[model samples]
Target: MDTAREFLENITAADQGDRVSRLRFAPHKPHAEPSFYEYSVLRGVRVESVRCGSTLYCSFTVPARLIDRNGKLSAGAIASLVDEIGAAAIHKCGKPMDVSVDMSIAYISDAKMNDELEITSRCLGQRGSYHSTGVLIRNRTTGEIVAQGRHSLFSLPATASKL
Candidate 1:
């Protein structure tokens, strides 16, 4: 918990120039914008932690609306959360880099609806044009691995216009 707090504080402090400031929670945060993953939810989403070089943390309180009849977070919603976290982490790596190429995600488990899910993102490595990272989404209460994925992103000097 201390680590999460520290991460949040660091990101907040470092966002003076509006670098990470734009990523903060907004009224539409949980609503899937036209660009990234969109999920229907009763609660909302917020960032838990983010660092300049290596770490990124985010969490979401999944509401009843997003769950399936089985009461678990839908796979699509989980994937969208992962994508948002991953993209944000990548954006913090340094300067904004365009999503020059294709990006993919692989899911591991189903998240329970109304569960508080915490996602941790790490920058694994970067070499030349290739950037590699991984995100692990887990149920904070159960410690169960809800989802995990690796993303291979191509960083370009050009930034893509937001949709």
Candidate 2:
């Protein structure tokens, strides 16, 4: 179909080269400097409390770097927060670091720079090597739910199996 051909054209070699050529790759100045992405995201995050080693409460303020051109917090940033907070809930409960296998998110509202947000994550349950967690992001100022997420991870055994 013409529709399929048109879509495919967008990802052609020429188009791919064009897209890559436009990107600016700038490395951080010093090797000693912390990764910019991690520093930006982790800064201003405050852990308010933890209970049962499976629930966590934290607060953060939307920062300018994470704001999209539309003047709202970027959805990607919200997803990253969900992954971090949700995984922490499981790891703090004495589980080994696991590889995330699935994640689902619902974006309910928008947030602007400097808006305070409350992030809560709790373990739903686990079976075998699988663990599930739920995360909710709420606007602390307006009491509006910004997003909700569910994350699932697969934790492998510490040692290799004979098979």
Candidate 3:
């Protein structure tokens, strides 16, 4: 299946949910405001596919706009991409909206502009209202790991009662 398309569709579907759900998943969309980080920083990023059940595989080329002064991918951009991709993976695993409780990243190496990156995020598991996810960002051409991230999220309970 087209994992990237599914990922984007999941995100868009979440955005079309209830008001509170939209707030939790995409606060910017409800207000009709621009999300610079999502729109600009991650403009060309695409979800390539989903594999091994719930693992989301994505890719994007390093744009010059996201490069740091030292001519490498900025840490902030990397972190944002990890967070967003992690959320997408979590959404695919049944939870469409959640609030991140904890997040951490380990930078392995630097990537320069024009480098293509392959990112993968998988849902580790969920307990009670808490969920755990892991992500890896690698240099597509060199097969080098550029960063790893972990995300912890709390799934909001459904507010409406079942009829």
Best by TM-score: 2
- TM-score per model over all chains: 0.62, 0.74, 0.74
Instruction: Give one digit per residue, the lDDT tens place, for model 3 in 1-163.
Output: 2443354455644565553353323345632553645676668988889887579998999998789999999999988887878877877344356778899999999999999999999999989778899999999999999999999988776575466
TM-score winner, 1 or 3:
3
Regions of model 1 farther than 4 Å from truth: 1-43, 92-97, 100-106, 158-163
TM-score of 2: 0.74
lDDT of 3 at 46: 89
TM-score of 3: 0.74
Instruction: Give the per-residue lDDT of model 2 (tens digit) for 1-163.
Output: 3443345456757578666465453576543553455566667889999998599999999988689999998999988888878888888344445778999999999999999999999999999878999999999999999999999988887678899
After superposition, which runs of candidate 2 have C-alpha atoms over 4 Å from their true positions? 1-36, 92-96
C-alpha RMSD between model 3 and the true structure: 11.2
Give each prediction's root-mean-square deviation over alpha carbons.
13.4, 9.4, 11.2
Better lDDT candidate (1, 3): 3
